[model samples]
Target: MTWDLLLSGGDADIAISGGRIAAIGPGLPRDAREIADVSGCLVTPGLIDLHTHVGPGYWGIDPDPIAWCSGVTTWVDAGSAGAYTVAGLRRVAETAAVRVHALLNISAVGLAGRTGESRDLANCDVALAIDAVQANRDLFHGIKVRIDAETVGANGVEPLRRGLEAAQACGVPVMVHIGTAPPSLDEVLDLLRPGDLMTHCASGIAAPLGPSVRAAAERGVLLDLGHGSGGFAFDVLERQLDAGLLPTTVSTDLHARSLHGPVFDLPTTMAKLLAVGVPLDGVVEAVTTHPARALGLSCGLAVGAPADIAVFDVRKEPFTVVDAHRQTRVSPIRLVNRATYVAGRLLPPRLPAPPAPWIPLTGAQRSALDHRTRAIRDLLTTPLVGVDGLAEQFPRRSK
Candidate 1:
């Protein structure tokens, strides 16, 4: 099998021909047309970011090109669309560089506010949600039900109940936002089916998957690490991980704030788990195969699957990782994304350069300038203040 170009071993490779991966293997045949060696790099299936906000309006400005540069090839815009603005999101997602998907917001108005709109049943019309999902079935993967403190307000379980009903009609999973739920996590987990998803799992005082959370997983519900700016907490993650529980899918929950701070990118979030002693294979599975399985996506390196892969270099580099609280930690090792690919296209590269400090001035030159300034300013406070006399005495020494 000849190929137009071949990335021979490292992280992953996509054998592209008709805009899809024809094959993926450890090595391409020697007869391949063009071969690029990727020795000393790590390659795996292309990253699938299941949660993001790549909309058309204020939210659309996010999930930009850097996301690709950072190693994400496919992304899901989480609740960036509502009834009012889904058309705009659909318009842009059609032409975006990265492969984009969406979990439609339950609100007919879409994501117009930071606080969300699940608090009012009047704002959440099941008829409208079903109409939007039916109209844009191709672009929409599921429904987004936000249950935050402000969004749920006094509505309690009513909003989620409506959301679940709509989800049933749509015949797709519902992505529930986990924060302040009135009926408790147990009730929320019970409402969701095996295919339904829970985002923002590591959040607030509420635990993502506890006894019932695990029961939800046992029943086939997908647990997403949807770590956003203010949504992720180390304590919550620790509790779950310590309980020997892992998420079915790991996502960045990328938005405006997380992209710049402690959350970093998908690779960084994976690195956090790695720093905490997660085996390399387990971490890789959580992001790649596991996520794909949870999404009911076939992403193994099997023949005929799309040739999408994410290549990285797991090195012991000094990384200053920040958390949600603005705390910085000097980590000894981290997963650094080197490149990414979707189908058969080689994504833009992400090679980092060595760090070097700036040498502003020579020592001798600095000393001479310091002495001259001191001699001149020394006279400003003197009883006899003579600028000309000072200049004459100084003589402007030069090295």
Candidate 2:
């Protein structure tokens, strides 16, 4: 458990009931159904993954298993759904017990069919985006626009302009994914006001440690390293840091494509940052308080804060840290989750609850949202992108 009082020092006890943090202190009445002692563990608020893609119309990975297994309580599905597609995707994401929220995609089609959502420009319908955000104001937290060569094609700055237009209307932050630019890094930074975000800041764009980034920071433009399948670099981040740039929040841009290699999970991302010279406290704050504030999610160990806590065992051993581009570094200490508690229900469950919306390792939601599975079945009945076609992704070199 990463307690705020941890730094102050002392053994404190916590009590939970009625899906809330009932109390916290050094001692309390021992009158409870069960009691567990945590003599040696680092306790903190439940980790919030501020960026993820975990629903259909994309290569969806059911979020609960990975999320809970990683000690994540709140998972934000970043731009995986949009105006036209959010309704069904929202259902799939919410069906899991993991608290799920989303940054509504600016494009109407979302990430369906490996399609470049904003490529058509017509997909950036501000009215439709506004409607979606308004309709799902409960779960929709912000707007997302991936302004890159693949997503936006040569449509320079227009998609972001439209996204900003809709975000301004909806009164939520606009998270801009910066990659192979149609709108130059400078152009994107220029358009972003304070509170707006630019993710993948270390993706080795022309985002040099220079005046533009400095100006953005000065104006309170929040930066995040959304370390995705291809969104981080060692030298790039180092240069930015040397030039006084820093991430306000850190998140795993977790998706099916990134689940295996390069970006494994949040702790792995945290370890990589630790290897890069960011202080331990900063690393902790990045995932905990930083994202909580950025996304306006209730987080902490206080009585009113969501009863979400993570117990970590700090390991003082050597570990391999991998960056988004497969770069490696060695870190001194590894933060390992000893246990996690969300709303007082212990994770790695002490006693399994009845058919809850929690971890469903084999749960296949057979609703209409299961259309992606049905489509996969249809493809299997016909043919896949064949072994050879698939093998192209992992080409073998001649012996």
Candidate 3:
């Protein structure tokens, strides 16, 4: 059977048919209906962000605009919706071009507001959470609970206990967000199961570097670098690296607040790992195979796998990148996405919407946004070509 699309002349020739990779080799047939020449680009599996917020809520942001340019195909909404608001998130997942899965919030209220979701213990209903996960098995991969002073308040680890109960009942893992004390970082880490994830493992505020943290790592609690606006810090990551602890997954907690600065996209977040001395291959694995394995999702660029691919122009130039704390470091290489595909269909370019009113932006950031808007407007308004560049479809009577 003929192939549907051919991605030729990249790192390797890939033939896609029936929404899966038909073949991969140095040379392939050029008879596909659509052919994209991707010479001088790095071809790899589409990235999977393990933590993000894309549902319709306070922190939600459209993932398509970022996905097309950043090569992220699967966006795991980390508790933007819970039992009460999951239907709305379902509608979003169904309509979006990119794949959107979620971790059901322990709090029934969800992130309708910034924080304090688990302040009221009634919101953390284990039965309701178990029901939600069991009912929507396709959409929810696990449960998410924010354990910190701001989110849990006086409840501390009680919400986490209820979340764990629900996760155990549903036979799914839990991804716990780590932040400032009250419950204390050790209290949260001790409760996580072997397969459970500790997001923001290298937070400046939490600084999960004590004996309990090491013990948790030894016992098999996976560490995830959920680099949100305040979750990541270069010093903290470096310290962890010195201790020989590498992040199991790298993700951008891309929401309204973090999108503009610290966590621009997955590529940028990956670069942060690079700056901290992680090898390129390691960083790629963290974003692709590792995260996919964590959530039991399909990923990779092998024959018979779903054709979710990304082509990037790999530049071996120095690039200055910053973490959530505004500390900067230079990366040896930069990965700029040139094209992204999902299920053998190329994603179309999409412009980002204006930042939300409540999202604070610096003067320089505002100016940059304005400049980008004008540039896009100018480009779309301009003519495709001059008169000479056009040809008439209908000839005159002589023709």
Candidate 4:
């Protein structure tokens, strides 16, 4: 059968039909309606970000503009919605071009504000969270709870316990955000189950390097590099690497606050792993197969799998990357995306909306954003070509 699309001249040619991979080999039949030449590019399964904020709330940011350029096809909104507001997030998932999944917040209020969703114990209703997960199994893959001092003031691990209860009831994992001490990091680590995820594992603030952290890792708890504004630190990651504990998944906790810097996108976050001595293949797996496995989502670039793919121009050169602490390191290679496809369809280009009023921007960043906006306006307003460039479909006959 003639394929719907064919990606040729890459590491391996891939033919797509009916939103699934028809075939993948050295040379595919050129019988497709459309073909994209991806010469010298690395073709792989679409990257899945295990942690992010892309629902309607205080932290949400449109994902399309970033996805098209970054080769991330799946975005997991990490606790941006809860039982009361999941419907709104569902609308976002339905309308977005990329795949949008969510981890339901343990707090019924969700992230309607910057923090303190679980401050009031009443909001951490296990019954409500369980119902939300049960009702929206199509959208929610797990539960999320921020167990930091500010987020769970005086409540400590109570919110987490309630979250765990809901997660167990739904048979889904819980992804907990760790931050400053009130309950302390050990108390939070003790509660996570085998498949449960600890985002911001390499946090500078939470510095999870104690015996409790190691014991948790041994017991099958997964560590996630949720590189948000203050989540990742090169020193912490290096120490973890020295101790033989590496992140199971590499994800950008990309939101309004961290999007502009620190955690630009998943690709950049992956580069941070590479900077700290992680193998390139391992890094790729962290963003693709590993995260997919964590959430029980589909992944991989094989026949019969969904035709969710990404092509990147792998540049083998010295590239400097930074972590949350503004710590810089040089990477040996960089993956520049050339194309992104989801369900056998190419993702169209999308411009990002301006940052929210509350988001703080540096002077240089503001200036660059203004420059880009002006450039786009200039390009759109300008005529495509002079009159001579136009061809008349209907010539003035018998004039």
Compute each candidate's TM-score over C-alphas: 0.80, 0.83, 0.98, 0.97
Model 3, 1-399: lDDT tens digits are 689999999878999999999999988879798999999888889999999999988899999999998899999999999899989899999999999989999999999999999999999999999999999999999999999999988898999999999999998899999998999888898898988999999999899989888888899889999999999999999999999899999999899999999899999898888887899999999999999999899999999999999889999999899988789999999999998898988999998999989899999999999999999999999998999999998988875
How far is each candidate from the true structure, as Cα RMSD in Å? 13.3, 13.6, 1.1, 1.4
- lDDT (Cα, 0-100) at 120 in candidate 3: 95
Off by over 4 Å in 2: 1-11, 205-208, 348-399
Q: Name the runs in model 1 displaced over 4 angstroms.
A: 11-15, 23-27, 57-60, 181-183, 318-320, 326-332, 348-399
Descending-lDDT candidate ranking: 4, 3, 2, 1
| Angstrom error at residue 46, model 4 | 0.8
- What's the true lDDT of residue 363 in model 3? 96
> Candidate 4, residues 1-399: lDDT per residue as tens digits?
899999999878999999999999988889999999998888889999999999998899999999998999999999999898988899999999999999999999999999999999999999988989998999999999998889998998999999999999999999999999989998999998999999999999999999999999999999999999999999999999999999999999999999989788888888888888899899999999999999999999999999999989989998899988889998888989888999998999899999999999999889989999999999999999999999998989895
Q: On a 0 to 1 TM-score scale, where does candidate 3 land against the true structure?
A: 0.98
Candidate 2 lDDT, 232-282, residue by residue in tens: 887888888888788888888887666655676888788888888999889
Error of 1 at 215 (Å): 3.3
Which of the two candidates, 1 or 4, achieves a greater TM-score against the reference? 4
What is each predicted model's overall lDDT from 0 to 1? 0.70, 0.76, 0.93, 0.93
- State residue 253's C-alpha deviation in candidate 4, in Å: 0.4
Q: What lDDT would candidate 3 get against the real structure?
A: 0.93
Please report how far candidate 3 places residue 349 from its true position, in Å. 0.6
Candidate 3 regions with alpha-carbon error over 4 angstroms = none
Model 4: colliding residue pairs: none
- Worst window of 10 by summed lDDT in candidate 3: 390-399
Model 1 agreement with the true structure over 1-399: per-residue lDDT tens digits: 676556776545545554455656665555556566778877777777888877853344444455556677778888878877887888768776667778888877666656757766777898988888899877887888887667778777677787788889988888888876565878778888878888877665466756888788788888788877766666677778888767777788876545545565888878766655667788778777776665555465656667676677768787666555554445566777776667666665332211112213346545865675677668556768556656565576699
